[model samples]
Target: MKKINLIIATTLFSITFSIGAFAQTETKIGALIGYGTEIENIGIGANAEFPIMEKLTISPSFIYYLPKDESGIKINWFEVNANANYYFLDEENIDVYGIAGLNYSSIKVKYENSFGLGGDFSSSDGRIGLNLGAGANFNIGSSITPFAELKYVIIDGGQLVVAAGVKFNL
Candidate 1:
């Protein structure tokens, strides 16, 4: 729908802006395992470090979460995020950075909730939200690097999250 299109457009704009303003390094792709209150998920992301300036990078990641409920029912959701990373400490092969950007998320309810008269209600929607986080990366001996990140969404009640992943330099 319109909202989905808007999310795609905005993401493209940001990636284009970053590429224009920063010289890009080689491309690297990785996967992640994330844990959050009320949810557990897995993610895959790509990293693009800026050329000439190694202190900055851009990361685009996608995630899918399993359903959970008090009554042992499942509720699924998915999200995609693009973050701008600024490294405060850039060592030989290690870097710790701060992140900020946009996240587009969609929630789907697979099971219906029973009403007072045993009726069921279910719904699904997509939301474009803000993302902010920080992470540290350590060079694992060679071209491989391991990283840990923590991010939170700017939702009304807030969504706290943590992730661990590895990146391979291309």
Candidate 2:
């Protein structure tokens, strides 16, 4: 009876400790900058990541492209995206991950002819699209992790996005 009691106590302790060690949730916020091919513009973005499972993370992000103007027409664009990332190689100091997401993009255009005979014109449009990307995170002992990613955005016209950012784990 004494031996059985000791074995059960030991097993319970081991299980409790193991669960405590691996059940931590990770949350991170980051600021990003990107360049896109279709628009030929620079974009600024921010994102937050939360762990859903041991190998999966969900990130919500927002990005805005700098306004561009040509021949009296000005265009502004922005996007909101939610991404699911799967980490295939999670190590002590590095993580390699693949991401897929859905994005909603909005564009506003304003036009005014250079001649005095023209009036103001404005239009807005929204598009729902998909994004696929791969990234690597390098942990440098601090709470900050630096990452770089390249993603393709499939919509009316395909766009390639390249970005880099630092994430703060909280």
Best by TM-score: 2
Task: Note the clash tally of each candidate.
Answer: 1, 0
Q: Compose the digit string of candidate 1's lDDT tens values, residues 1-170.
A: 57766765775676566566653455455677777553555444444443335666677777767555647355767677877788898787777899898877777666555545565656777777888989988876777778888999875456777888887765
TM-score of each: 0.74, 0.83
Per-residue lDDT of candidate 2, residues 1-170 (tens digit): 34434534653454345345445666777899999898899999887677768889877777889999988889998777778889999888889999899877788899986687868899987778999999889989998999888888889997888989999876
Over 4 Å off, model 1: 1-24, 38-53, 69-73, 112-117
Task: List where candidate 2 sits over 4 angstroms from the true fold.
Answer: 1-24
Spell out the clash pairs found in candidate 2: none
**Overall lDDT per candidate, in order of appearance:** 0.70, 0.81
